[model samples]
Target: MSIKGAIKGLLATLASGCLAAAVGGIVVYAHGFSALASLRDGPLPPVQQTRLFADLAAALDGLGVILALLIVLVAGGSMAWVFLAGRFIAGPLAALRQALGDHAASLGVHLPREEAEDPWTPEGLGTTLRGLLELVASREADLVASEAHLAAVIDAIPVGILAVESTGYIRSDNLAARLLFGQTDPLVGKNLSALIAPPVHPGIPGRGKDTALDMVTRAAQTHETLAVHCWRDPSLFPADVTARTVSRGGSLTTVVTVHETTERRRAEAERAHHRALVSAALEASTDGFLVVDLDGVVISWNRRYYDLLGLDSDVVPRLPQAQRYERVRAVMADPDAFHALYDRLVNDPATTVVETMHLAGGRRLDVFTGPFRVDGVVAGRLWTERDITERERVQADMARAKEEAENALAELKETQAHLVEAEKMASLGQLVAGIAHEINTPIGIAVTAASHIADEARELAVAVKANLLRRSTFESFLETVHDSATVLLSNVRRAAELIQSFKQVAVDQTSDERRLFDLATYTQEVLLSLGPSLRKAPQRVEVDIPPDLMLDSYPGAMARVLANLVLNALMHAFPGLPAAGTRDDTPDAPREAVGFPGCLYLSARSLDDERVEMRVADNGVGMTAEVRRRAFDPFFTTRRGQGGSGLGLHIVYNLVTRTLGGRIEIDSAPGQGTCFVLTLPRRAPEVPVAAPSQCDASGTLGGDSTV
Candidate 1:
């Protein structure tokens, strides 16, 4: 307990002790009187009385002793109770003092929640103390937060802030100051001159403390600050510094703000470099270029613009756009047209226009006007002007040359057509010769058989005149006559059949006849008619067709197509191999062999959907890509001087497409051989125009096939 409370308790204990002593004395006195009275009023004789009195005295003594003991007990109990109360109160009071001292030292920081409560203190007093400590703790926390926020704000500032004393010592500096100075150590107490070098340009004075302070003081009067350039080593940073003096607490403090200008200066240099590059590009351009804003305000123009317009170069861009247009209009052939186009372009932001302008000096100009977009939105209009006088002249010349070339090509096709007809007539003559040769043998045999029969008849007449004829001779003569008659009839019929076959082929080639006929039978007849030429060449001619396939198409056209294809293959394929009759059937022989063993021509027909597909292929010398492309072109032949008129395939192309409603394609390469595939409808088309799908190569039909 506190000393005051302890002393008060001691005094109260003494007073209680005195009260107890007084009460004890009173009780003893009363008890003693009662005992004495009992002795005085004795009921015995003098000697008995004396003995009784002694006994009574002893009883009274006993009573007195009992009274004394009671007094002692009361005093001792009062003292002991006060001492125990003092000890219990002192323990808590001491603990409370120590706790309060610790809390005060820490400015009321929190302590362990497990500490015992001070029983000596009252509840209200403890509550009041706790509230006060909490208030102090909250204020302390807020103070710490505020300090941290202020420090962060200062650190985030871009410019360096330095507060220096007039004595040249750095009193305080923010984070920016240390960063700008490239110093990580504490800046306080360091001399200001030691951190930064002197200003390079002397015009910016007040770098030293004395001069800076003088300037700062003068600036205070003028309400302006002095600026200087300071550079520091190790980081070679150039900073712009401004200083002003402030009077605080009766001392002069200079507050300097430093701003680094390196990045700004670098950005300015890059901008200048880009401007130079743009200027060079504009000057080097051949076309006239002009840039105008959305308001028709001319922003810039290159030198070529004046040169192209034949205007004076002295005109400046600052002139209004109207004045510039008027100057340009003086040389325009139609000024109103230019004005109308300009207005249209300005109103419709998305439209770009290109026009040719005929100028006063006969110079042609190609002018283009379009929107100049920046970031996907139209900002202005850009005009580019190019002179096209020479280009027009060259184009006119090329047109004339192309017309001449076309005329020459037409004449050449006419000549080739005649040659192709001549070739067909020559082929016909050869067929006639072969037929004549075949018929001559049969006619000669028939003539010899008839002559023999006449001789036998004459000999029998001689025998009858001589009268030496026998019945056996007559019978033999009859038998001989029967054999001769039979032989004569057979030979004559064979000759007539040969004549009929040749006649049918020749008539069909000259005339187009559409009739229902078996394709296999007709194809066989056509190939058989070409037996003479096929026999001369060491080549295999295969006819693959279904026997029952029938078509109501122009058989004449088909006959011509097959004949022309066979002719082309024989003449172009196996160029150096001599005519060696029919080829041997050797399936394993290489197709590319240069000898006579490899010459093969395949003519196969198959029925496609509602049409017939015929393929004429050869394992002979094939064409290159260029040749195959122009293979069906009129008068286009690789063998110009060697009897190749180039119209063979062309005629075949026409017959397949124009006569019969079909498409034809030629697939050929240098050494791999050539194939001509023709697809015809079941019935011939009435219209005499070529089918749109016909072509000599891969998917393109480049020419007309009309009669």
Candidate 2:
């Protein structure tokens, strides 16, 4: 039974005994008093009465003493029972209550002092104690669950975790801690110093002397994190370790957390390398480079920038943006303008500016300024400057030279035109002289025949007048007159024909008139005009032109082209041969023109309805490849001092190509003879032809000749 139940039953038994004792004492008192009264009223002697009273008194006193003794015995017995119960049961119950309170306090549960002191029945106390026990049990169960959850959470973390003792032993370690150490066995009860190196604190006093255990012990005492190296077998990797002290069951334990930093370290290293490369590239550049932050602070600059600006290296480093600008502006030709431009650029970050700046030393610089970005944000502006003083000077010189060249070229062109006209006039003079010589012979023949006719007429008249003339004499005189008249008429006609041919050829050669004419007839006329020159050439002339071929083009250009080709061939083709009617000692003479017989072939044919092909070829000495390539170039002559002007073929090429709208080509080789091929349009282009220049020339009707 409980202490409360046992105490209650003992108290009921004491109450029953006291009530019985009270009842028995009251009955004895009543009976003794009644016997004394009867003795006093009855016929008994005084002495006997006195003795009976004494006996009654003594009996009552004895009864009173017995009652007192019984009472004392009862009280003493109850006290003993109470003391025994207090010593055995209450003491234990009180102790149990105190213990329960302490246990509840430990479980974060508190019981009131009034509840412990309250009067309690057996059932109430038993119920209270049972409830307290149940609460303690629940708290213990919750504690167990919380500890298990905490352990699971610690294990689930990716970073290594360890529960360590101050003595450097590992009480417990998570899976990550074991993995970091490359071990599968439990790390519990192992020394932490064996698995990893001690965390180094370079800034701390006496750091080099501290061991792994000492560092860990210090961390537990100070509760600070240590960044250190962790040994992962062959290498040491960076890690962050934090040790904190925790008290459990009156013992101090340190909880350490480890985080590896291999990837972060690698990323830092890569960034550093890239920064170094950029710095090197900037330093090696020839152009001045400068970078400034948004706050107008100079962030970086290359050595070239200092050189270009003539800045003091030592003082500039300590200068603010404004002061640095002042120093730079002092060296500029326009200080105010430079400062204004700087302000404008700072205000408008998005604008790119390119301008020229003049320095104090007469040097010109090309400056370019643009915004630079970092991570898509405009962080600063980059300035680049290049010296261009030498370039500007060169450009100025070139401009002056070009103007002078143009003036010189104009003068040369005018002089060339005069030379070409002189050549034309000279050619015309030669033709006139030849034609005059040819006409003189026929005219002299006509004169002599007329004189003979006159003599015959006179003789016949004299015979008739004397009256003695016979018929036979008269017939002879008439026959003589008739024959002389016929001879005179034929010679005069031959002279007239030569004059007409000369007039037509001279007119065509000097003008650029367009006309529709048969190709064969035109070619024949041209050859006829050059007959005087051709007759003296060593080569035989051949003409194979088709009579039906026609052209509507510049007849003057065509005539000039034909004349030049024939003269060029006569002068240069046959070596050692005298040129066209000129003596061997003349300025225009050939070289060694005796061994081989020569032929000059002139041919024309219609290539298509719109075009025609003409060829002037020679079977004498041929031109070399070098000469052929530049055959039509002006002022290029093989016979320089031999009186070859070299303008003959050049003029022919210009007239045929520019004036008559034709294309010309040369086909020749050493010892193989030479051929000049001309392809011409039936109807020439209608564009106005200009006078001959150095490279290009054209001709117009009734205008200056393009020679």
Best by TM-score: 2
**Best by the lDDT measure:** 2
Evaluate residue 402 in candidate 1 and report its C-alpha lDDT on the 0 to 100 scale.
88
Q: Per-residue lDDT of 1-707 in model 1, one digit per residue for the tens?
A: 43334334434432112111121112122222333343333233447523532453355343332101110112121210011122223443344445444544464443333235433333333343445445555665787899899988988998888888888788888898887877787679977666554443355444454543444445456666444445465445545566777888789888777788788768878999998889889889888888888887877778887788888655745677788778877778888887887678767977899999877778788999888898999988888899888889888888898898888767655555556567667657766766877688889999999999999999999999999899999999999999998999999999898888778777676666767877787777677667777777777676667787788888767777787788788888767755553455443333444345345544445567588787777777788888887787756678899988767777787677777878888777787777788888887777454332224454345554232
Instruction: Give one digit per residue, the lDDT tens place, for model 2 in 1-707.
Output: 43344334443433112111111122211222444444333344547634643554455453332111111112211201011111123444454345545545665766533355342333344345345445555665787899899888988899998888878899999989988877798789988777657545343233676777777777767878776677777767777777788997779888888888778878989989988898889888878888888887888888787787777655674689888888888999998899899789877997799999999889899999999999989999898888888889998998888888877766655666777888788778766876877788889999999999888778878887998689899888778878888889899999898888778778877777777878888788777777677776656677888887888887878887888888888888887853343322221112222234466778877888899899888766888777876777777788999988878887887777677888888877776677889999999987354764344322222323345
lDDT of each: 0.65, 0.69
* Model 2 residue 63 CA deviation in Å: 41
What TM-score does model 2 achieve against the real structure? 0.70
Candidate 1 TM-score over all chains jointly: 0.54
Give the clashing residue pairs of candidate 2, or none. 575-591, 575-592, 575-593, 576-591, 576-592, 576-593
Instruction: Show where candidate 2 strays beyond 4 Å.
Output: 1-97, 109-137, 151-229, 233-258, 313-318, 339-352, 370-380, 426-430, 437-444, 447-485, 571-595, 620-628, 644-649, 688-707
